[model samples]
Target: MQLINYQMQRFWQYGGFNPDLYLFIPLSQTRYVTRGYNQVSQTWSPVLKKHSNVSEALFRVRATKAQSTLSRAQRKRNLKDAFSLSHCIQGKNIAIIDDVITTGSTMDAAAQTCLDAGAAKVWAFATSLTPLLGK
Candidate 1:
C-alpha cells in the first residue's frame, strides 16, 4: 500500500498526470495497523507538481461494516455520502485510482462525490478489481 501511494505521488512526472484529475484517497476508518504500509511524508517533486490537480478526501461519514462484510445494498448505503470533494471538479475527467475495487459501491460513492462537486465526468482506475468470478 505504501508503495502504491508512493507511485501515485510520483505519477505527476508522467505526462498522463494533470491538475484536472482529482486524486482522492480514502481514509482508513479503523485504527488497526496495516500489514505494511505508511502514509507518504515528504512530497516528491512530481507530487508537488500534481498538488494543484490532486487532492484528498476524508469522507467516511460513518463507520459501518467493511465492504467484505456487507451485502451489496448495505455496502452502497454504508458508503453513501462517505466522501466529499476538496476542489471544484466540474467539467473535468476525474480519475479515481484506488488499490482495489470490490462491490464498486465505494467507487460509486467517490464518483458521486465528484459529481456532486460539479465534475463533468468521472473515470475510475484500480490496481485490482474483484469480479464476480465463475458466476
Candidate 2:
C-alpha cells in the first residue's frame, strides 16, 4: 500500500488534480476487526492528512473467496453482488488497492461496485501481477 499511496500522491501532484480521491479496500475474509501491523495504512495516514482531498480509504464492502483457486467463470460468479459499497463515490476518481492482480476479475468486480456507487473513474494500482495459480 505504501507504493500505491506514494503513486497516488505523485499522481495528485503531477497529474491533473481531481477534487476527490478515495482508496477502496476489500475487507478480510472474516470481520474480526483486528488491527494488525498495516504498513500501508500506517504510511498513508500522514499523507492523507497532508492532503485533505483524500476523502476516505474506507472498507465499505467485503469479498468472499481469496480468488486463488476459483475458475475464471467461478471467480466471476463468486463475486456477483458479493460486495457492496456503503459510501457515495459518485463522480470521483477512486484508486483500488490490492497486494496483487492476476486476472483482474476481483479488481473488476470491486471497481464495478465503486462505479455503480457513482464513481467516475476507477484506477487500479498493485504491487505485482503474477499470472501463476494462487496469485
Candidate 3:
C-alpha cells in the first residue's frame, strides 16, 4: 500500500494531476466468490482519500482464461465483451487499478469499457508489471 501511495504521488507530481475517480478492475463472479475481495481495492483503499471513491461502475460479465496462462493475442481475445459498465461515467477521468500487469490486455479492455461508457479519459495503474519476454 505504501509503495502504491509513493508511486501515485510521483505520478501525480509528474503528470500534474490525479484522477477524478478510481476504478478497481472487477473480477468475475466466480473469481470474486473464491477470493472474497478484490485485491486491487483492498490494497489501495487505505491510501485513497474520501473524495476519490472506488467506483464499482465496471464489472466482468463473463469469465475468461487467466491472462498468465495465455499469450498476448489470446489475452486480448479472451477479454472481448467481458466487461460492462453499470452507470454513466460521462466526463469522468478514471484510473483503473490492478495488482499486477501481465500483458496489459485486461487493463486495456477495462479502460475501453469506461471510455465506451462516456468517460473523458482512462488511465491504468498496477503495482507491478510483468514483461512479455519474447512477444
Give each model a TM-score: 0.63, 0.69, 0.90
What range of 10 consecutive residues in model 2 has the weakest lDDT sum?
Answer: 31-40
Candidate 2: count the clashes.
1
Q: Which candidate is the best by lDDT?
A: 3
Query: lDDT tens digits, residues 1-135, model 3?
Result: 788788877887798656878888888899899989988888888877654567888889999887877788999999999999888889988989898998889999999888888889898888788888765
- What candidate 1 gets wrong by more than 4 Å, as runs, is 1-19, 29-52, 132-135
Q: Cα miss at 89, model 3 (Å)?
A: 0.5
Which lDDT tens digits does candidate 2 get at residues 17-126?
A: 45466463545535335545444444555546665655444453454775778777777877777667656766887766655677877788878888888888887766
Each model's lDDT comes to 0.61, 0.65, 0.85
Top-scoring candidate (TM-score): 3
Q: Model 2 compared with the native: what TM-score?
A: 0.69
Q: Can you tell me which runs of candidate 3 are displaced by over 4 Å?
A: 133-135
Q: What's model 2's lDDT at 130?
A: 81
Q: List clashing residue pairs in candidate 1.
A: 19-53, 90-118, 91-120
Ranking according to lDDT, highest score first: 3, 2, 1
| Candidate 3: residue 76 lDDT (0-100) | 97
Candidate 1's clash total is 3
Whichever of 1 and 3 has more lDDT, that candidate is 3
